[model samples]
Target: MNATTDLLRVDAVKKSYGPIQVLHGVSMSVARGEVFAIIGPNGAGKTTMFKVMTGEVASNGGTIHFDGRDVTRMPAYERVRQGFGRTFQVARVFRDFTVLDNVIVAVEARRRHTGEAVGSWRNCAPSADIRDEAMSLLADVKLDALADGAARFLSHGDKKRLEFVIALAGRPSILMLDEPTAGMSPSDRSDIAKLVSRTRKERGITVVMTEHDMDVVFGLADRIMVMNYGEVVSTGTVDEVRNDPKVREVYLGKEMVSA
Candidate 1:
């Protein structure tokens, strides 16, 4: 896809801390409604890139554009306002809150002004309309039956699903999922993969994902980006990436390429 038409473009981005530099002129593009996967060994700057894109961490150099607007200096909340939603590698939900409450909290935050969207939903339980909407979001993820249950009581996989529901409630145009299947079982991975697929199909949201599971990445990604040592080694479709010698050497390794 052309850079001008890309839904998201990270150009020549760089990041540093004290004397250490993490990202080195990294650049990539994601088209609208595409599943773009970033894969690399740990500390390869995947999380740092996410942090920069979501506006949690400032970049030392380069620019970031989303849907044709410059957002390099935009705050995290503003990115959310710009229809960019993200799920952390770890599932983050209200421990003391119920499943429905978790979704309501996200919905409330999504609708409220930036600064006012903090704390639990307990102080401001959702209205009937929001409750119904939150329930619908839960149903979309097949978690409606557990709406009243405490989030702390849910399993890891269930909590991940809850995260997806919460992200859906916010109505993100581009969803960023970091390590979406980090600790999941095969079944759980498949389920979450399907959920991501369905989100793309049903909502037409562009999905930017970082997953270690090759099966999930190759299976779901319309384009795959391989990172090694804070640089992009390859960016192409599955077949193109699979056959790239640089990818096979730097990212995939001999075992995986052979597989």
Candidate 2:
């Protein structure tokens, strides 16, 4: 991909937790409208890398630029405001609120004044425009009928689906998901993958994901980056990565080589 056209770029990103260095000079670029997957064995620093990108943790060094602007020092919420949406390893939603309320809250957050949050549902009901938009998002995830149901009452898979929709609530330019399908059944995993693909296609959003399941990684990602011991070891298309001895070694790396 052309450097000029890249939407997100990470240059020599370094992070250390106390005396332990977690990410060492990691660098990669994600082009607009592509599903880029970061894959590796546990302790490979993928999540830390995700956190760094999301501004959840501070990086000791390196830079992150989005859409021609340097966002290296930007705060997490600022990053979200800059159109970077993220979901955690464990899907999170408002357990106390209804499904529709959960989405309404996120949607309001997206359009509200900067530094102002839509805190309580008690003070006001969403306008018709907000409700229409929130309900539309629920329908996108097949949760329309359950819009009034309590979020906590939904099954794990449904909760995960809701999180996906929540990420879309802001209509982000880039969506970041960490281990989206972890702990899901094969069928549920497939559902998430389809939702991801649909989102990318329909909205033309760039997707950055770190997933444990090789099936989902290989199935969803347009390009793959493999990391090990806090360093990026390889990056390529699906076929290129699958056939790479280095990636297969560190990723399926040690195991495949040992076998």
Candidate 3:
């Protein structure tokens, strides 16, 4: 792929927690509109790497660039302004808020970040336009029916869908998902996977994700990056990474990948 087509670039990113190093010279590039997956063992530093990429945590060293600009030191909010949308491993919706309100908040935040004069936010009710837009997002995730329902009352799969809707409200250029299908039944996992694939296709957004389910990973990812012990073991097309000797030794075994 052409270098210019790359939307996200991580170069030698390093992170540490106290004396324990978590990410060691990690580097990868995500092309625009590609579904990229990062996989490894439990302590492989995938989440830590995500934190550094999204500005949730500061890196001890190295640089991160997005859309042709350096964002290594950018704060989380500012990164959101630059079109980074993220959903956590655990769905982090506003439990007390209604499903509609949860998305309303996200749309409002996006407006604020972009300096779109949305009127006084103090005691402000969601405008008709925002409500329509928010509902549209929810509908995309098939959660519009639950618009007035409390988020806390939704099933775990529905909550994850709500979170995805919230992220979509930001109109992100790239979407990052951490274990999007975690802690769900196989059916729910399949639902989330389909939602992700459909959303990416419809929006033309780049996706960076980590998933433990190899079936979901192989089914959705255009490319895969394998990590081990805070380092990148391999990065390539799914077939290439799946066949990599190093990746086989450290992460996926022959049986695992073949199955």
Candidate 4:
């Protein structure tokens, strides 16, 4: 892909927690409107990488560029405003609020900046546009019927789906998800997978996700990046990464290699 077309670029990025290093000289780029998957075994620093990208966890070294601007030191909220959005491994929701309300809050945050009231839900002003957009986002995630329900009452899978909708509320150019299928049953996992694919297809949003499920990674990724010991071991189309000996030795292991 052309460097000019890349939406996000991470150059020799490194991160540490006190004396321990978590990411070592990791570098990669994600093009606009592409589905990019980062896969690894447990403790490969996938979540830490996402946090670094979002500026939730400060990196010890390296540069992060988003939409051609350097954002390595930008605050998390600032990153969100710049069209980068992410979902956690664990669903984060406003438990007491209705699903619609949760998304409305995010939409309001995305647009309101500071010192501005989100205003009454029934307000007829243009600010009410957030509510309309939030409701539309809920419908996109197949949660239109649950719009009035308390987020705490949603099923685990539905809550994850709701979180996806909330992420969309920001109108993000790039959506990063960490273990989106975690804790989901097989059927629910399939449902979320379909929802993700639909989001990419219908909205043309770029997707970057990390997953432990090989089937999910292989089935959904347009391209894959494999990381080990905080460094990217290899990255390529699914088949190329699958055939890489270094990836096999570090991640797939000998038994799978033999198979």
Candidate 5:
């Protein structure tokens, strides 16, 4: 892909925790407006890889380029400003705050980051425009009705959806979801998958996700990257990865080919 189309490029990223190493020179590229998935069994360094890319933790080596700028050393919040929005494996939200407040906080943060004058949360309530924008984002995830409810009281599935809305408030160019459907029922999982698909298509947002559910992975990914023992084993389209013998032996079973 050309420079304009290649939105994210990770060149030989490596990470280590003292004596132990987690990532061994991992490299990948994500084109704009595509769903790229990284899949593997437990302890495959998938989450670590996400952490590195998102700047939650520093990479020991290599570089990360986004939107044609080098962002390898950028802080997590700065990366967010640079258009990287992410959700963790567990839903992270303001549990004590009302659902509406949760998204309002995100919207205000985005505005503040962009040099807009936002009233401090302690000094004043969110402005009408801010409230409207937050509500609009909540409505997108069907969380508008629960706007006044305490976030802690929401169900796990609802919390996941809320977190998604909060992420959307950041106005991301690329969203990295770490297990977007982790603890949901099959139906709830389907809901999140559909939400992701619909949102990506509507907004033309690029998505990079790591998920264990084969159905979700195959359903969403335009290209799949298989990781094993901290390194990539395969990278290709759905059919190519599914048919790869190495991926089958290390991750997918032979039965998956027929399915």
Candidate 6:
């Protein structure tokens, strides 16, 4: 695809903490509306990579381009304003805030033209339009019934859904999710996978996620990027990656036993 169609591009990105290097010259790209998955074993730097992409953690080397702008040095809030949104592996919600209010906060954050002025607790006049949009998102995530309930009261599955709504409030061109299915029940995991699939098909939002659940990755991702240690060992479709001997050796801890 052309530059105009690329939503995110990471070129030769590297990161190190003191004497230990975590990401080793990684490079990848996400198209405008594709669901991409990054799968690897534990401590493979997947979350670190997400943090670097969102500017939460600075990369020691390489470039990150979002919507054709160089954002390697941009701060996290600035990146959020630039249509790069992310959800953490751990559910982060305002425990006391109403479900709707939590999403409204994100909406306000996105509405501000100047990222510096946006505050997590800032109160903005809830315009009819904003309310409608926020409510719509809540409904989309099946949280409309609990819109007025305290965020902490929601179940774990619902909390994950709320995070998705919060991320979407930014109208992001790229949505990065860190283990969206972690700590979820089997049915809840399936629900989330279906929600992600529907979101991708209906909203055309580019999805990039790091997940350990191979079932979730295989079910939702259009493409998979497999990393071993600090380096990407394979990038391909789900079946291709599953069939790659090197990927199996690193991720599954054994060579693929042929039928």
Candidate maximizing lDDT: 5
CA lDDT of each candidate?
Answer: 0.89, 0.89, 0.93, 0.88, 0.94, 0.87
Q: State the displacement of the C-alpha of residue 27, model 2, in Å, after optimal TM-score superposition.
A: 0.3
Cα-based lDDT at residue 31, candidate 5:
98
What does candidate 4's lDDT look like per residue over 5-78, in tens digits?
Answer: 89999999999898999999999999888889998888898889999998898889999999889999999989
The per-residue C-alpha lDDT of model 5 at residue 138 equals 88
Q: How well is each residue in 1-259 modelled by candidate 6, as lDDT tens digits? A: 2577788899999999999999999999888899999988888889999999999999999999988899999999899888877898889989899999999888877777644334345555676677788999999877999999999999988998999999999888788999999999999999999998998888888999998877888889988898878899999887788888888788855433242
Rate residue 220 of model 2 by lDDT. Answer: 92
Task: Name the runs in model 2 displaced over 4 angstroms.
Answer: 1-4, 114-123, 253-259
Evaluate model 3: give its lDDT.
0.93
TM-score of 1: 0.93
Per-residue lDDT of model 3, residues 1-259, tens digit only: 2447999999999999999999999999999999999999999999999999999999999999999999999998889889999999999999999999999999988887778656655746877788889998888778899999999999999999998888889999999999999999999999999989998999999999999999999999999999999999999998999889999999899898797
CA lDDT, candidate 5, residue 252: 92
lDDT tens digits, residue span 43-108, model 1: 888999999999999999999999989999999988999989899899998989999999988887
TM-score of candidate 4 against the unseen true structure: 0.91
The candidate that wins on TM-score is: 5
TM-score of each: 0.93, 0.92, 0.96, 0.91, 0.97, 0.92
Candidate 3 stretches with Cα past 4 Å from truth are 1-3, 117-123
Badly placed stretches (over 4 Å) of model 6 are 114-125, 253-259
Off by over 4 Å in 5: 117-123
* Sliding window of 10 residues with minimal summed lDDT for model 3: 115-124
lDDT of 1 at 146: 96
The better candidate by lDDT, 3 or 5, is 5
Q: Tell me the tens digit of each residue's lDDT in model 5 across 165-203.
A: 898899999999999999999999999999999999999
lDDT (Cα, 0-100) at 28 in candidate 4:
90
Q: Which residue pairs collide in model 2, if any? A: 248-253, 249-253, 249-254, 250-253
List, in order, the clash count of every candidate structure.
0, 4, 0, 0, 0, 0
Clashing pairs in model 5, backbone N/Cα/C closer than 3 A = none
